[model samples]
Target chain A: MIEDKKTKILIVEDEMIINKMYAEELRSQGFLVLTATNGGEGLELALREKPDLILLDILMPIMDGLTMMSKLREKDLYGKNVPIILLTNLSASEEKIMSAITKNEPAYYLIKSDWDLSQIVEKIKERLSRKV
Target chain B: MRSQIQKKNFEEDLTNARIAAQNVLEDLDIEKTKVEKERAKEVAILLSIGDGLVVTDENGNIMLINKVAEKLLGRKKEEVMGKVFSDAILGIEDKEGKVISLEKRPMNLALTAGTATVNSIYYYVRKNKTRFPVAITVTPIVFEGKVIGAVEVFRDITHEREIDEEKSEFISLASHQLKTPPTAVKLLTERLLSGKMGTLTEKQKEYLNDIRFSNQRMIDLTNALLNVSRIELGAFTIQVQKKNACAIVQSVLDELEPITKGEQPKLKTIFPEQNIMLMLDEPLFRMIITNLVTNAIHYTASEGEIVVECKTINKGETVGGKLLKENYFVVVISDTGYGIPQVQQNKVFTKFFRADNAREKHVNGTGLGLYIAKSIMDHSGGLIWFMSRENKGSVFYAAIPMTGMRTKVGT
Candidate 1:
C-alpha cells in the first residue's frame, strides 16, 4: 500500500455515474481528484487546475473527451509533462486515437466497458509513473 | 429452172416464217413479265407488314423502308431512305444509364469490329423526338459476297421496365424507414439498461437485457433490409478509418461475456505483440465481430473452447488462408462447438435464411449476420467467409484492409 496524497487527477466523462465512481475511487486511493461532465469544463479544469493526470472518455455529447484533450494540449496546458489516459467504452476507436497521441507519449489507454472499476486508480498511477 | 423456182419459194417462205416466229416470241415474253411483277408485289406487301423494317446497303446507306419503319422513324420513305444508318435510328439507355446499342448497327463497335456483338434494349427516336421502346434485331443482308443491305426489325417495351423499377424503389424506401425504429429503440433501451438513468432489480435488469437482445435482433433485420436496398440502388456507404483489430475483438468478447457467464467456457485469445491495425468503421466493424463470436458461443457447449485467432499478413496479392489478404490483418474466431450442416452451408450469407439444425439449437437470429459481415468486408475490400460441418466445428473469419478501401464496387 502506498502513502496518502500522491497527485491530483481530473476525470472527463459524460456519464454522471461513471464520473462519480471514478472520482471517488481515485480519491480513496489517496489522490486529489476533480471532474467535469462535458469536454468544455474538462478542458477548463484540466488547464486551470492543471491536474497531474487526466482520464478522458471518447464518446461524450458536447465536446467529446478527445476534442478536450486536443484543445488542452494545443495550448500546452499540462506544463509539457502531465500524463493523460483516455478511458473509453469505444476502445477500438479510441485506441487508434490514443496510439496517435502516444506518439507524443501521452499516459495510456483503458477500455471502461471492459475494465473493472476497482482497477482504474491503480492502473492510472502505474501508467503515469512509468518512464518510456 | 426447177431449182431456181424452188429457191425463190424457199426464200419467200423463210421471210414469212421468220416474221411470225419473232412476233410470237415477243407476245410470250410480255405475259411472263406481267406474272413476275405480280409475285414481286406480293413479296413487297409481306415485307412492309412487319412491326418495323429498314434496309441499308453494304455501305450503310438507307435503301428501303417499310410502312412501320416510316411511322416509327417519323418520316416518309422519300425522306429517310437515303440517310446513313447512324442518322436513321437513335440510342437507348438502361436504368444505370448505360447506352445499350443494337448488335448489328454498322456504327456500333461490336458489329463493325468483328467482335461478338450485344443486343440492347432498343428505343427508336424519330426526328420529331418521339420514342418507341422496342426489341430490335438487325440482320446484315449479304448479296453475292457483299453486304448489300441490312434489315432492322423492332417492337415496344416501356411498361415492363417502368413496373420493375417502381417495385424496387418502393421496397427500398420501405426498408429505409423500417431501419430508424429499431435504432431508436436500441439507444433508448441501452440508456435504461446501462444503469445510466436509474436503478433496477435483477429481474427488471433481465427483462431489459432481453429487450436489448430483441432490439438488437431488429437492428439486424433493419440492416439486412437497408443492405438489400443499398445494393440495388448502388448507394451503400463505407467510412473507413484507422482501427485496431485486436481491440475490436476484445470488445466483442467482452460484450458477449454475458452469454458465456454461466457456461464457464474458457476463451483463449491469441493477441499479437503489435496491434493488428487496419482501416474500418469501428461501430460497423464491431457489429461484424460481435455477431460472429456471439453466434459461436451460442452454439458451443459449456466448458468448450472458443479460440480467437489474430494474425497480420504483409500486403501483396497472395490470398492463402481464410480472409487473409496480402496487405491486412485477419481476425479468425474458431469454436469447438456445433458445426453447420453441409446442405445449409451454401445459403450462409443469404438474408433471413438460416439452417434448420441451427434454428433448432440456437433459435434467435435474423440470419443476416454473415450477410452483413460479408457486405462490410466487401465494401472495405476485405474478405469474410466461414468453414463449418455437422458435429465438427465452425470458424468464422473476418479480414480488415489496411489501405483505404478507395475502390468502390457497384451493385
Candidate 2:
C-alpha cells in the first residue's frame, strides 16, 4: 500500500469545467485521470485505457453515460466488474438512465450539486477499496 | 296692423318648436334600440362562451343558464329555470367531496360577502349523477348597494386539469435538465476552494469561498424549485424500500455538519439500540428529516440546543389522520430558535409563504421547504406539524407510517 502507484480514474462528464476540476482533484489525490467529453468517446477510452475506476455522467450530447457503459461492458469483460459511479445532475427517475443502470453494472448515483468534490473523491476511494 | 303680423309669426314659431320636439323623441327611441341591441350582443357573447354560466336571483333561484351550462349540468335552461340554485345542481361539494354548506357555496359567499368569489375548485353533480370538477367564479349582481342576483361562470376543468398535469410534467423534466449546468459549476467551485489546482493566497482563497457560497445557494434554490415543480405537477414518485430510520437521519446530519462547523449548535440525538427498519423511499424520508433538522439548525442561535429524537408509536395511536395499529415511527426535531409567529403558524406550510419573523431573520429561505415536506408527508402516509411560540422555540413532529401507506391522491 505504501509503495502504491497512482490509481487511474476515468471521469466521463460533458461539461468542461466539471471534467477539468474533477480530473485535477483526482490527480491531487494521486490518481492518474483520463477524460472524455461524451459517452461515445468515453466508451472508446474505457476500452483502450482500462482505468482502475470510472466516474460516469448520465446526460451527454452524443450517446449518454449509460449507453457508453453498456457498450464498454459488451466490449470488455472486466468493465462489468469495474466500479463506476454516476456523476450527473439528472433525476433518478429518468427512464433511460435507469435502464442503462440495470443493463450494465452496479454503480453509485451521485448528484453533482449534492456532493462536494472532496466527498466525491472519498466515494471514489471507498468504491475502489470495496473492490479490493 | 304690426301687432297682428307679430302674433301670426309667434304661432308659426310654436308650430316649428313642436315639430322639433317630435324629431327629438324619435332619436331617443333609436338610441334606446341601439343600447338594447348592444346588451343583447353582450348576452349572446356570454352564452357563446365554452364556460357554463348560471345566473341566480337574490333568493338563489336560477334566473338564467347558458347552452354550455345546460350541457354541463345535463339540465335544460327551461327545466332548471326558477329552481333553487343548489337543488337544480344538487351534488355540489368541496374538493374533498364533502357537501358544501349554503354559506360556503361560492354564490352564497358572493351574495353575503358582497364580493366576487373567484377560482374556487368545486365538484358539481350532473343530472346523470356523475360528478366532475369545475373551476368557478361567482359574482354578485349588485344594484343600489343590494345583492340583487349572482352570476356564476364555471368551466369543466377535467381537460384543463389534464393540460395542467402535462405542463407540470414538462416543468419537472425541464427543471431536472436545468440543474446539470449548475451542478457542474458547483463541483468546479468546490474543487477550486479545496486547493485542488494549487496553493492560493488568502485573498484568492476568500474569493473562491465566495464563489463556492454563491454556487451552493444556486444548488439549494434549484433543488427547491425542482421539488416544488415535481409536487405541483403531480410528478412525484415514491419508492419504498426497507432501511434503518436512524441511518437516514445520520446521513442528513452528516451532510449539514460541514456547513455548521463554525458556531455549531449542540445536536442531541436519541437513537434506538436496534434501529427500526422503515419502509420508506430513502430520498423522501431524507428530504423530510433533512428539511426539519436543517430548519432547526438554521433558525436556532449559535450554541443553542437542538434535539433530534426518533421513537416508535404503536397501532391505534391517533397520529395524523390514520389510526395506526402497525408500528409507526415518529421523528421529533425541536430547537430553541426564533419560533414561528403565532399568527402566521397556520400559513407555515403554505407554498411560497414566509412568516414575517422568518423573512426578517433569514434572507435565503425560499419558504418552499415546509410546503414540500408537507406534500411529501401527505403522499407518504405521514403527517408534519409543529408547536411554536414567538421568540421561545419550535418543536416539529413528523410521523411516518412504517407499513408504506401511500396514496395515489394528489392535488
Candidate 3:
C-alpha cells in the first residue's frame, strides 16, 4: 500500500458518535480526515483545507447539506470537479427529495444503515482510485 | 185542514236539504283530486332522481323500486315488487364480501326504529356478481304519527374510496422517511460488533448486538411502511428486463440464511432445470419471493420442514378450474408450521392483522408483510394467494406472467 500523504478528505456530519466513528475509520485506511459537526463549519474548513474529497451529511444544526453544496459550488477548490459523496441517514423513500439531490450528480448517495464501515471505505478507495 | 198544512212544510224542507248535500259532494271531489296530484308529484320526483331509490312498506316488503334502484341491484321492478326487502336485494355485500344481515339493512333499521337513518357505506354487488362501493341513506316516511314506509337512497362512491387511499399513501411515505436515523445506527453497530473493524471484548459485543437488534427492528418497520405507501400510490412502474427467476430467489434465500442458521428449519428447493426467464422488475420480484419465504420460515417450528418449488406451466393449463393463460411462472412455498386459523383466514392480508398463533409465538412482526406483498403482486400484474389450516401447515402460491401478457388484479 502506498502512503499518499496529499490525499485529504472532509467529513461533515452532525451526529457526534457517527462523525467520530467515520473519521477514525477513514484515518485507519490511510487518508487524512478532517471533520466538522455541522454544514457551516464544514464549509469554512472545506474552503480553507481544499481537501480532495468531501463526505457530506444532509441534515445539520446550523446549515443543511444541500445549502452547503450550493455554496461550495461557488468556490474554486470545492467546485463541481471535487466529488461529494452524501453520507446521510435520510431514507431514499421520498422520490422528490432524492431526485433533487441527485441532480447535481454527487459521487454517491449511501444510506448509512444499508452499508458497513468497510463497505464505505472500499467505496471511497474506488472513487479516489478512479480519480487518480 | 191541519194535516195538509204540515205535509206542505215537510216537502219544502226536504227540497232545501237536497241542494245543500249536492254542494258538499262537489267540495269533496275537489279535495280528492288535489291529494292525487300531490301523490303523483312525489312519485315523479323519486323516479327522476339520480341516486338509487327503494321504498319498503312498514313490514319491509318492497313497495316501489325506482329505475335506478332496479339497475343498481340488477333486478327488474316486476320481480322485486311485493317481495321482502332483503330477499329482493340479494346483491349487497359488506367490504369483506360477507352478506349483510337483514336486521342491519338500512331500510329495515329505518322501518323498525321509526326514525331516519342516514350516511352509511357498503359494497353493492349486482346480479352478475360485479361489485361497487356505495353510500346510502334510509329515511322513514311517517304520516299522522304512524310509520308508513321507509325510503332508501344510495349513490356509488368508487371514486371517493380512491381518493381516501391516496391520502393514506402520503402519510405512509412520510413515516417511512422518518426511520432513516435508526437504520443507520443499527448498521453501524452491526459492523463494529461483527469484528470487521476490529476485535471487541465479550461484554462490548453483547451490548453492540443489543443495539443492532433494536435498530434492525426500526429498519423493518420503516421498510414495511414505505412498501405500503408505494403500493397504494400505484408507484410501481414496470421496468421490465430479462431476469432469471430461480437466481433471484436463490439470492433472497442466501440473505435469509443467517436468520435460520441456529435453529434452522429443514429447507428444500426444487427449481426448474432451465433458469426460468421472465420480463419483470428484479427488486419487486425479489420482495414478493422474500416475503413468502420469510413468513414460512418465521412461522415454522425449529424441526419443521420448508419446501420451495419453482416451475413453468404452459398456457391454458388450469389449476382447480382457474385458467392460467400464456406461459406462467409459479413459486410455491410450503411449511409445516402453526397454520392460520380457519376463522381468520380471510383477513390474512389485511393491514395490522396477525394470526392469533403467530402473535403469540413471534412478537416482532409488524403484520404489514403480507399486505405489502399482496400490494406488490397486484401492481406487478401478478397473483398471490395461500391455503392454510390451523396446526397443520400453510402453502403460499405466487404466479406471474412469463410473457408480455399481464393481469392487473388487486384486492
Task: Give the top-scoring candidate (lDDT).
Answer: 2
1 against 2, candidate with superior lDDT:
2
TM-score of each model's B chain? 0.54, 0.62, 0.61
Off by over 4 Å in 1: A1-132, B1-216, B281-284, B314-328, B400-404, B407-411
User: What is the per-residue lDDT of model 3 for residues B1-411, given as tens digits with 9 covering 90 to 100?
Assistant: 798889998888888788778777877788888889889998998788998888888887888888988888888999889888766655677766888887787777788888676754578888788999889888998989888888888878888888977786776656645665675575478558758678999999988888888787877777677667656665434466888888888888889999767897888898865587788777778878888998898999989989988888778986423578767788889999999999999999998899999998788998998898788776677878888888889999888887732433233
Candidate 2, pairs of clashing residues:
B315-B324, B315-B325, B316-B324
- Whole-model alpha-carbon lDDT for candidate 1: 0.68
- Per-residue C-alpha lDDT of model 2 across residues B188-260, encoded as one tens digit per residue: 6676666646788999989978887777787788788888877776656677778888788878888888766
lDDT of 1 by residue, B1-411 (tens): 999999999999999999999888888789788888887896587566667666666566677678877777677877766777654455454434455555544334322543322244456566676566666666666567555556666655567656755775676667545644554454455556657557988999999889877877765565556555554444455556777768877878888887768865578889864476666667667878887887788788776888888876666544334433366667778888888999888888877788887788778766777777777676667788788878778988777666644434243
- Cα deviation in Å at residue B76, candidate 3? 29
Candidates ranked by lDDT: 2, 3, 1
**Alpha carbon deviation, residue B58, candidate 2 (Å):** 29
Task: Report the lDDT of model 3 for residue A66.
Answer: 75
Could you give candidate 1's per-residue lDDT for residues A1-132 as a string of tens digits? Answer: 355646878889777766766776576667888988889888888778888788887767789876776677678835356777887543232234645566535646765543545566668868767754
For residues A55-109, write the lDDT of model 2, one tens digit per residue: 9987788988877777777775777677788887776655566667777666768
True-contact fraction in model 2 equals 0.75
